[model samples]
Target: MASRLFKRPWTRSNDGSEATTASRPETPDDDDFHDAEEAVLHPDAHEEGGLAFNNRELLESQRSAIYELIRDMGMKFLTGHINLINMSLPVKMFEPRSYLEKLTDVWVYPALLTKAASCTDPVERMRWTVTWFVAGLQHVFQSWRKPFNPLLGETYQASQPDGSTVQMEQISHHPPISAFQITGPGYLFVGHSQPEVTFRANAIKTTAKGMRMLHFADGTSIDIVYPAYYMRGILSGTPRGEMVGTARFTDATHGLVCDVTFGKADGAAPSDRLLNRSDTCTATLCQLDRTNLASAQANSSASADASQERGWSKRLGGLTGRLTSLSLINRADNGLPEGSQVIGRGLGNWLSYFEWDHHRYWSIGESHATLWQPDPAALPSDCRFREDLVALRAGDVKQSQVLKEQLEVRQRQDAKLRKP
Candidate 1:
């Protein structure tokens, strides 16, 4: 049978940017968006009291199957935390792409990094880096479906329209680590992530753990730390994906550090949810003194949000000399001395553009360039060659499940043999 549901079509504006909801004209895609409500629980699908994640609302039979599997797992699931590193998920729960490809989503707007690299001012460069970081996060919560995990030794290679090249390798299996390096004009971004996922009651949390470094040709480098992700209401209510916690961007070369706090998902307002602004974030940049360094490194999501609630005004007056909103940044006179003063602040949602010092940096709707597309000349061991993924893409559910199981069994046996 043909698929029953079709969400929005990928539409673009005349400027090549993804069309914003504000400017998009009525089209068949609107009907698709409505049809999607039956399969996916989006913001508009909420009931009177709150939103819910009903298995009946899902696309295929696999959602109910997975729900049953989890329910049967029951008390076993109650055990402290269930790690998904070794888990073989149902193929239907995955998008037909591999985790390696997902990593490249960070470079959707290659221009952001190029702008950062070309900047002469270290603080301005840091601002651009933070903007790039914020802009790239829009993809993480686009849907609840997970990307297929990369098999050990798997590799993916692609390039950008801007002449940048990207390469990713599934370097390890037991702990499941993937490494990638992207080379662009005047900058090199290399990082390895071992994503850790834990299952909690009615929710799952994931953290991308590892080292990420961006080196510019001018010898200026940035050290990045990513935030935590949460997919809530998996069992019954509305299935929602949110990004929480704080991400740090530090430029040691200039003694400047930026702390970006992704606020909790705002479910109270339907309007905010519809526009992808339900999850908002704010960023503050300050000089890296020993005291400031200690404080920045010690921030958790709770503490970070608590600090903001306690009053950024007081903090801006003293040691942490930076405003927390774009409006305040705009009011600051540009003639002020550089050091020991508030440079600029940023405020925006994680799923769209943000304003820095009252200037809008990048918009998710405005990014129309295709930076990375799958290269046809992939190696034999590439994720594109995975039998299960191939089967799924071909719409052979049973064969996909069987192939997935076989692959998982082989992986387990190989891992056991490698153990001391």
Candidate 2:
């Protein structure tokens, strides 16, 4: 027999008394959860992406045991012999939310988009957008625990009171891919992401490759590519996460490009080693000559001669910032002429208030605006109502484990049936 997906007990009291609608705790309305005044931020953002973890000490012990097992199977874990993706850890190691829901962490500070859209200056607008891009990565630095994998076709949709809505759907199952779209006042963000995970002896690396595009009402758009991440010290030492490599942001409309280089906070001796102490980045913005680009493209298509190529771009000011503290300063080449470009500087943290060019951009505590909240009236197909995830959220580890296995089995059976 098929099992019921959503089994929340909001309709009845524990004593079997019928609960009044007003007395009953809010079930999923599929909209914003609380008023700005009543909104509460989770203590550990990773552990409680939406729902709190059941037991802290027990989970930590479980994690230590798992780590020891992985350490013992050093070669097996390091090599492709052990596929971590297919390996299921205890439900205690997973956050209740699905990967689709976890993606919403980026929108915790959605006001950044509004600032970018409203800005008149093209350079300043890109800066705001870049700030938002960096802000969105905050969650990745918090934790590396596993999240529930959404079933194919499962969806999650929510809208803020301001009419800004975000929707995510699990589009693929084999190599799980999530498709997302965010529509707000003056901008539309759409992307399809597929996470690539690999485990090494020393670290576990994760990279999500996707086509992320942010479009504004003014016909300007930005193309984004994220950096690679690594969770180091898996076998021994204290485990920590680091964002490595260069993340690219190209504003093709304005002929502007920003390449952010992430490094360790300790500015230690520069080595080819991937391990970094903390999350720090330097973003260099450059302006491409549109006329030169057009000419170069035309020439390239007309003839394959390299001698006919032209200079394509010139360096603009850049932002040297720390992701943890949310402080960035204008960094320009010493050789560049002064007063040639309007360089801006920003300092302070994003948690309280982030001041850019002496103006506050984000003040989470003081601001009355509520962060993104899931709606109770979401579609029946939403992942929020998924049996396994719901059980996990309620701290029913055994039930969740069974449900998760059942769901996986059903998915496998469906795939087999579909195959000719």
Candidate 3:
């Protein structure tokens, strides 16, 4: 009767920040971390997960009717193990953001990381690199809907607001791989990602492979790998997502490995309404402090165990950035007009790993904005300029489905004609 998933919470309005108060406790020592947090989270069920979409105590009281309709239509059968390229789903389920735009969000990194390639200190380099990677993640998991499948050979490009530009090419059709390149004044990036999926009765897992590669003018280089993700709350529960797996940034040139594992989920009890943080991992990373991280990384055996297990927290619903603490919160609108909404750092369902405090560490914000602009005159193969693309991105489900199928059919017909 209730929904069950997020993988991401709407932390705030897209416009601004929220005000802070003395609601949070003074920082706790490593041993007192869990006990401290337990005292802080609201005890009321309705006040849970910190709402951002609405001012009400609970996040938009979801209706069981949607699930009923989906069941009446046998939606589950079509949901599993199908090639998304050929499958069709309602567009209302997806975020309007495209994967290309998603890429640009993270590409804001090169600017933050240009100095990464030039720094001699491994820790400093890893620090900057990790920040770049994490910044792009704020909005990645906000919805359960999938992006419109870029037709085979469909491409996309962006000329950022900053002086940078990025290009992406959908290289394969069957397995669906996308390759991209970004060039700017001080940096260059080249990477490709291929997705492998596993569909479970109650969840869908999407694994993105081939870490990004970035180069600085000084010949410094590194490769980045994304954390694996899962769409949960399928069928009978709320739909949401969780960023699992260890994201890695390996600087072969600098002999450094920065691995960040999103921590475990924490609900009030063993059988709480929440159904997130997979069942595979054992350690609860929600409360890891810098001392604990340093202790873990300094101990050769613990570091090895971390690498071998590659598994961090399975609860707490926050992330443990290898050597840092990160606290995330979004602004909540107290039923105010959009213009009247007060902004601050705390509201919504915040995800913090305690590794990032504005005064503590990893706090250089806004260093990753891009300079280029979106180019309107994209080539025929570009996804942005594809016919009907605007409608697809605008969430017009029926129109997008028709266009998707038409393009696929056209490609097949042309292939048949090419057969000699």
**lDDT of every model, 2 decimals:** 0.65, 0.58, 0.46
Cα displacement (angstroms), candidate 2, residue 21, comes to 59
Select the stronger candidate by lDDT from 1 and 2.
Answer: 1
Question: What digit string (tens of lDDT, one per residue) describes model 2 on residues 81-105?
Answer: 3435556666766778888877777
Q: What does the lDDT read for residue 400 in candidate 1? A: 87
The C-alpha stretches of model 1 lying farther than 4 A from their native spots are 1-62, 78-80, 264-278, 290-342, 369-371
Residue 266 CA error for candidate 3 (Å)?
13
lDDT of 1 at 157: 87
Clashes of each: 4, 9, 49
Model 1: per-residue lDDT, tens digit, 217-328? 9988787878888877666556766767778776656767677776633332344442234456777787755554443344433443564685633422331232222111
Model 1: ten consecutive residues of lowest lDDT: 326-335
Say which prediction, candidate 1 or candidate 3, comes out ahead on lDDT.
1
True-structure lDDT of candidate 3 = 0.46
Best of the two (2, 3) by lDDT: 2
lDDT of 3 at 225: 63
Q: What is the TM-score of each candidate against the true structure?
A: 0.71, 0.67, 0.58
Q: lDDT tens string, model 3, 1-420?
A: 132232222111223332232333344553332122211211121222321222222223222323443575475644656434345544544445455555555455455565555566655655665656654454445333456666666677777554567787665555566767777666677766677666556656777654366677766665666776665554443455555756655444433444454533443234432323231111111223344334433453443344435332121012111211110100011111122221111111212222222211222221224434566887766666665567766757578667756776887787687669
